[model samples]
Target chain A: MTRLTRSAALGAVGMLAASAPAFAQSIDEKVNEAFANSTGWFVSFIFSPFPGTTFPWIVMWLVVAATVFTLYFGFVQFRTFGHAIRLVRGDYSDPNDAGEVSHFQALATALSGTVGLGNIAGVAVAVGIGGPGATFWMILAGLLGMASKFTECTLGVKYRNEYADGTVSGGPMYYMTKGFAERGLPGGRFLAILFSIFCILGALGGGNMFQANQAHAQLTNVVGDYPGWITGVIFAGIVFAVIVGGLKSIAKVTEKVVPIMGVMYVATAVVILIMNADMIGWAFGQIFAGAFTGLGVAGGMVGALIQGFKRAAFSNEAGVGSAAIAHSAVRTKEPITEGFVSLLEPFIDTVVICTMTALVIIITQQLIIDETTGLYMLNEAGTAIATVDGNSGVALTSAAFSSAFGWFQYVLALAVILFAFSTMISWSYYGLKAWTYLFGEGKTTELVFKVIFCIFVVIGAAASLGPVIDFSDAAIFAMAVVNIFALYFLMPIVRGELGSYLDRLQSGKIKKYN
Target chain B: MPSKIVVGFDGSESAKRALDFAVAQAKAKGAGIVIAHVLEWSPYSFLTPTELEERHKRRGEELARAETALLKPVVDSLKDSGVEVSTALKYGHIAETLASVTKAESASQIVIGRTGHSSLSSRLFGSVAGSLAQAAPVPVTIVP
Candidate 1:
C-alpha cells in the first residue's frame, strides 16, 4: 500500500511538471497586461509627440522650464558655480555648530540617487538611439536643469515640515501644499496628491523596476542566460531583507560600495580616454557634427535634442523633485545655500559622469561611426548599433568596456549589480515617503508598501527591458510635469530667500568660517 | 579654583556614581567640577539625508535635556559643596572626545563611570574605559 501511494504521488508530480509552462505563461501574460495597464496612460500623456514634430511634449516641457529658470534667476547656475564648490567644501560651515547634514553629505546623497543605472544603461540608450549628438544636448540640459534644481530645493527646505518628533518629510508634496497655501493659490492639496501619486508610480517603475531589470541583464552577461525570475527572486529576497526586514548594515555597506565603485568607474573611463588620447578630439567632433547634421539619423537634430534632454532629466533627476527631497534634510538656516550645493548634482551626473560614459562609448568606436558620412553606421542588415549585443542598454555599454579591456565586462557587471542594488534601496525610501504621504504614516501601512516594493523587484527582473523603460520614463517624467508646474509660481519665494542670503553674506552677517 | 576635575556624564546610574566620586575628589582637592557630556557622532556613519537632518534636532534636544535634567540638578545638589561647577557638551567618539575635553579644559584628571554597554562591542572595538585610560591627557578614574 505504501509503494502504491508513493508511485501515485510521483505520477501526479510528473503530470504537473508537464503542464507548468502553460500555467506559468498564462500568469506571465496576465502580469504583463496588469503592469502595462498600470502606467500606460501616464506614459502616453507625458511622451506623446508635440504637433508637427518628432519631439515629445515632455522634452519641451522640461527644456522650457530650465531655460526660464536660468533666465529668471539671472543665470544663477553659472554665477554661483564657484560659490557652490565652496559650500560643498565647507568653507562657510562652522564645524563646532551642528548642522543636520554637511553640504557635501546632502549633495552626495542626492548624487547617489541620480547617478546609477541612468548614467550607465540610460545613457547607452540615448547615445544608441539619438547618436553621439545626444551628449551635446545632455550637457546643455544638465546646465539649465541646475537652475530648476535650485528653485525646487530652496522651496523644499523653506516649506519643509518639521514635526514634534523631530522627523522631517519634505519634497514636492510638502512644498506644494505649503508653498501654494502661502502664495494663496488654489489646488495646493490637489496638486500635492497628484504629485505623490506620480512619485509613487515613478519610484516603483523607474527607481525600482528599471534598476532590477538592468542589474539582471548585466548578471546575464557574466553568467549565461537563465530565467530572469530566478535572479529576480534572489535579488528580491535580499532586497526584502534589507528594506523590509530592516537590515541596515547591508544598506550601509552598499552606501560605501556604490560611491567607491562610481569613482572607479569614472577613473577607468578617464584612463581609457587617456590611453586613446588622440581620439578625444575626434570624439568631440563626432558629438558636435552629429548634433547638427543628424549624421544620417532620422529626425535630425530634434531627435537628438529630445533624447538628450529626456535622458539628462532622467539621469540627473534635476527637475524630477526627487533631489529636492534628498536636499531638504540639509542643515541650513539659509535654504538657498542647500540650493547652491544642489546645483553640483546635475553638473556631476550629466556634465561630468554622463559625459564620461558617452565619451568612452564614443572613443571605443562601438557605435561604428562612418568617417565619410559622419553618421552612425548601420549593420549590413541596416539595423542600429543596439542590435550589437541583442541587449542595447547595458549590453552596448558592456561591449564598449570589452573593446578596451576585454575582461572589463566582469568589472562592469560588478558595478552594475552594486549600482542597481543601491539604486533600488534608494528608490524604496523615496517610494515609502510617497506611500506614507498618500496613506497616513503607520507601521502596518509602511509594511504593505515595503512588501509591494520587494515584489516588484522580482517582476522587474523577470520582465523584458522595453516595457520597463517605457513605464520608468513615463512615471519619472510625469513627476517632472507636476513638480515643474509648482516651480513656476513658487520661484518668487525662492528668489526672496536667495536675495536675503546674498545680502547677509555681503554684509558679513553670515560669516565665512574658513 | 586652582584645579579642575572633568566628570563624564550620560544620565546613567553608573555615570551618577562617577559624578558623586568626582564631587568627592573636587572637594578633597579644592578643585572645580566640569561635567562633560559627549555624544557619539561620526561623519562617516552612513545615513539618509532625512535621517541626518532629523538627527541634528535630536542632538540639540539631547544637549538641552542633559543641561537641565542631568547637569543642573547636579549643580544644585553641589551648590553648597564649595566646588565650582560647569558643563561641556560635545558630539564625537565617546572616549576620545572625553579625553580631548580633558585637554581643552585644562583639567587635572578625569572621572567616568564603568559602563556595561554591549560586551560584544567592547570585545571587538575596545571599551570606553580602555580608550579613556590610553587617550586621556591626565589620569582617568573609572568609578565602579
Candidate 2:
C-alpha cells in the first residue's frame, strides 16, 4: 500500500532536486534586484561628487577630517609615537587599575578588526584601479588618520558610561552626546542617533556581509565554484554559535588563527620582496612617480588619490568610530593613554601592513606595464591597471604571492577565511552595541541584533548585492561624518588630558614599571 | 617575634593541607596567616569586543563567588583558631599575583599546595605551584 505513494513521492523529490538550482538562481536574482532598486538613491547620495571634481564627497570628508585632527593635535601621531609604543608595552600601567584589560589587549582586538580583508582585497582594489600612485596617498592618509584615531579614542574613554554592574560602554555615540553637552552644544542627541543608525547598518553590511562575500570568493578561487549560500550558511552558523549560542571557544580559535595568518601573510610578502630585491627601488619609484603623474593610469593622478584614501580609511577605520568602541574598554584611568596607544592602530594596519601588500603587488609586476610608453597599461574600459590573468582584489594579491611560492594560494585562502571570520565576530559585537544604544541595552534586545547580523552574513554571500555593499560603504563613511564632527568639538578636552598626562609623566606622578 | 606567612588557597584539598601546614608554622612562630586567593586570568587571550565590554562585570561576579564559596567558608571554619587570619583576592596570573600579595602584606614566607592539573594548558604554562616556586620573592614552602 505504501510502495506506490512512496515511489511518486520519490519522483517528486527528484524533480525538485533537479530544479533547485534554477529556483535558487531566480530567488537570488530577485533579492539582488530588490536591494539594488531600494539602495540606489541612498548610495548615490553618499558617494555624491565634491565640487568641480570626480572624487566622492565621502572620501574628501575623511581626508579633510584626518588633516584637521593632525593639525589640531599638533601632529600628535608623530610626537606620541614613542610614548604609544611604551604604553602598549605596559610601561606606565598601574597594577591597581580598576579593570583587567591591558593596553596590548585593547590594541590587538582593534587591530584584528581592521587588519583584515581591507589589507588583502582592498589594497588590490586600490592598486588595480588607481595604479601605484594610490599607495602614496594611502600611506599619507593612514599616517594622518592616526591623529583621528587618537582624538576619537580619547573621547571614547573619557565620556564612556560605566554601568552599576561595572560593564563599560563608549564610542562616538557617548562622546557625541556627553562631550557636546558639556560644551553646551545642540544636536548632540541627533548626531548620536545618526551615528548609531549608521554604525548598526554599517556593521551589518561592511562588517558582516562584505567579509562573508570575500571569504566565499577566496574559497572559490582555491576550490571550484559552488553556491555561495553554502559558504554563507556555514559562516552564519559559526557566527551565530559565537554571538548567540555563546560558544566563544570557536571565536577564540578563529581569533588565534587570524593573527598567525596575518604574520604568515606578512612573511610571504617579505619573502617575495626579498626575492625581487632588485625591483625594490623600482617599485618605490613607480609608487612616487605614479602618485604624481599616474603614469597614464586610468583617471590619472586623481583616480589614484581617490582609491588610495578610500581604501586607507576603509582599512584602518581610524575616523569611522569603530575602533573607539574597542578602545573604550581599556582599564586605564587616564583616557589619554588609550589615545596614545590607538595612534598605532592606523600605523600598523595601513602604513605597515597595507604598504607591504602594495609593495608586493608592484614588485611582482601584477599590473600590466605598457611597453612603448613606459607607463601602466589600462584595461579596455580604461578604468584600471590591466593585470596579469585579469586578476583583481584578493586574487590579484594571491597571484602576486603565488608568483613567488606556487602553493601560497592555499595559505592565502585559509588566511582570508580566518580574517573574514574574525572580522565577522568583531563586527557582530560592534553592531550589537549600536543596536542596544538605539533600543535600550538588554538581553533580548542584543539577541535581536545578533540574529539579524547572522542573517545578513547569509544574504551577503548567497546574493549578488552590489548596491547593498555600496550602501554599507556609504554607511561607514556616514559614521565618519558624525564622528569627526564630534571630534572637532571635543579635541580641546583631549588636549587637556594630554597636557596633564604629560605633566604627570614629567613629575613622576605616574610610575614607570620595570 | 610576630611575623606574617602568606598561604595560597583555592579550597582544594591540597590547599587545605597547605593551610594546615601554614597554621601550624604560624602558631609555632606566634605569627599571622594571610590567605591569598588568585583568580587566574591571561591578558594575552583573544576576546570578542562584547566579551571585553562585559569583562569587568563578570570579574566582579567571579570575585564575589570566590569569596563566598571558596574563601569565606574556609575562613569561617577556622574562626575558632587563635592565629590571626585575613584574605587577599585579585584577578591576574596566579604566581605573579600571589607573589605581589606576599610583597604587599610583608609576609616572611609563602605557602602553597602542590596541586596537579593535567590539562594541556597547565602542561604548557606549568602549574601554579610550579610557577610560584620559581617566582616567589621570599622563601616558598610547597606543602604536599
Candidate 3:
C-alpha cells in the first residue's frame, strides 16, 4: 500500500510538470469564453427579465414556490420542527422497515449535497453585492424553503418505486409520474421526463462542476496560481474514485466528513463572532437596518432582496428537488417522518451555517459602504469588492476567517476541498441516477455518465468564474422551475400523507421504540 | 426441548475459541447452541437511495456468505458431535441486537470472543464484547 501510494504521488508530480506549459496558455479564459458563447442563450432565457433591474425571474420562481408551500402546508415546517428532530434521532424509526438507511443518514447525505461552496462563497457574494440587508432576506428564504423541502420529500417517499430487490428509485421524476397518474392528471410521463433531463443537467452543472470550480479557486488562492486544469485533473481523479464506488462509499465519506467540516467551519465562525463579540450587536443592527433601508447598495431594498433570495435558493436548494432523491432512501414506513426529518436540512444549510458565514463577514467589517454615494465601492466589473483581499466570494470568506486567526486560510482551504469533494461525489450520484433514468440502467451507460461527469470537473476548474456561475445558476434554476411545477401538482398527495401520519401519531398508534 | 446457549460467532480465531467454549457448556448442560453473527451497522451514515439499495443487496450477500462459508460448516460439525445447533445473521448495534436475539430465542446464556482489536482502538470505537458483558439479558462468557 505504501509503495502504491508513493508511486501515485510521483506520477501526479510528473503530470504536473508535464502540464506546466499548458498553464501559461490561458486555457481557462478560452474555456470561459467558449462556455459563455455556447450557453449564453440558455442561461439568459432561464435567468430572464425583471426589466430595468438585475433580478432574475428564476429567483422569484423558487422564492414564490417556497412561500406558497409554507402557506399551503399551514407552516408545517415550523409546526413539525420538533418532530423532525425526534425523527432524525431515530425515535420513530423501526429497524424492520424496508428502506436502505436511517433518517439521520438520509438527512446527512442530502445536507452534504446542499451545504457546499454556496454556504461559504455564495453568502459572501450575496452580502458583497446586496450589502448586510441581504442576510435578513436570505434567512427568510431559508425559513420558507423548509416548507418546500417538506412538500417534495414527502412525495419522494410516498410515490417512490420499490423494486423486487428492495432498492428504491424516486425524486421529482417518479413523484411527477406516479402522483400525477394517481391524481388522473395529464402529462405525467412528459413532465417526469422533462424533470429528469433538467435534473441531469443541473447535477452536472451546479452540483459537480460548480463545486470543482470553487474548490480550484480556493486551492489556487492558498497554493499560488497554477493552471486550474491541474486542480481539475486531481479533483476529477479523486472524485471519480469515490463516486465510482457508488452512493454507499460516497455516503460513508460524506456522513463522516460533512458533520466534522460543518462543525469545524461553524466553530471557527463562532470563535470569530465571540472574538468580535462587541461588534455582533452592531452587525445584527446593520443587517436589520439594511434589510429595510437597503443601506447603500445599488438597487436599494430590491437589490438586497434579490441577492438574498437568489443566494438562499442557491444555498439550501429546497425547491430544486435534489434532496428528494437522497431523502427517498431512508428506512421508514411513515414517509411523512422523512419529510419532517428533511425540513431540518435547509435550516442547517442556509439558516444556521450560511448565517454563520454571513455573521463572520459582517463582524469582520469585510464590505465597505460609500456614505456619500449611497453605494458600495465597485470593482472594474461594477460588483462590490472586499477590501481585505481585493477579492469577493470565497476569497472574502477566507479573509474574514484570516482576520481573526492568521493561519485560518489554510484551514478554510482544507474545508473547501472537503466540501467540494463531498459535493462532487453526491452530485455524481444524482447525475448518474438521472442518467440511468433516461438511458436505462447498465454498467456501460453508468460508466459513460461517470466519465462525462469527471471531464466536466476539469472543464469547470479550467473556466473563469463568470461562465461557471452563470451556467450553474441557469441549470439549477431550470431544475427548480420543473421541480416546483411538479410539487404544485403533487402537494395534495403530501398534504394527505402528512394528515394521516399526524393523526396516527396524535392517536398514539405509531409505536416509538426509542 | 433443551435450554439454549447463544454464542456470538464471526469466523475469527477468537470466535472459534468462543464457539468451542459454548459447545462445552452446551454439552455439559445438555443445551442447544445458537450461533449468532451480528454485523455492526451505524444508523448515522449518509447514503443515497441507489447506495442504500446497493447496501441492502450487499447485506444480503454478506449474510449468505457467512452462512455458506462459516455458519454451515460449524453447525454441521457441532451436529456431528451430537449437539443441536442453529445460526443467525442480523444487522444492528452489536451488543444490543445480540441481547435482543438472546431474549427472543429464550437462550439462557451468551458467549462472545474478546475482540482482536487493540484496547485503545476498542475504547475509542466501543468494544462489543465489553458492552455485551454488561448489558446482555443473560450471563455472558467472554473467550479471550
| Leading candidate by lDDT | 2
Name the regions of candidate 3 deviating beyond 4 angstroms.
Answer: A1-23, A51-54, A97-99, A244-255, A370-381, B1-3, B48-50, B80-84, B115-120
RMSD of 1: 6.3
| TM-score of every prediction relative to native | 0.85, 0.94, 0.93
CAPRI band for model 1: acceptable
Q: Under CAPRI classification, how is model 3 graded?
A: acceptable
Q: Give the per-residue lDDT of model 1 (tens digit) for A1-514.
A: 1336634643554455456756644654666677777767867877999888667988889999999999999899998999999988878876565435678777777777888988988888888877889899999999999999999988888888888877777888998999999999999889888888888888889888899889878876775555555556667877887877777667777788788988988998999999999999999998898788767654667777777888999999888888888887777778899999998899988999899989999898777656786567655544344344444788888888778888889989888988888778777887888888899989999999989888898788777887889999999988999999999989999888888888887898987877
lDDT pick, better of 2 and 3? 2
lDDT of 1 at A59: 89
Scored by CA lDDT, what does every candidate get?
0.83, 0.86, 0.83
Q: Interface RMSD computed for candidate 3 is what?
A: 3.2
RMSD of each: 6.3, 4.9, 2.9
Question: Over the stretch A122-204, how does candidate 3's per-residue lDDT look in tens digits?
Answer: 99989988888999999999999999999888888888878777577878888888889999999888887888888888888
- For B1-144, candidate 1 gives per-residue lDDT tens digits of 478999999889999999999999888988998999887775445565435557767767887887888778877887888888988888768888898788888999999998866688898989899988988989999998
Best by DockQ: 2
Q: What's model 3's lDDT at A314?
A: 89
- Lowest summed lDDT over 10 consecutive residues: which window, candidate 2 chain A? A1-10
Overall local distance difference test of candidate 1: 0.83
Interface RMSD of each: 2.8, 2.1, 3.2
- Regarding DockQ, does 2 or 3 come out ahead? 2
Q: Using alpha carbons, what is the TM-score of model 2?
A: 0.94
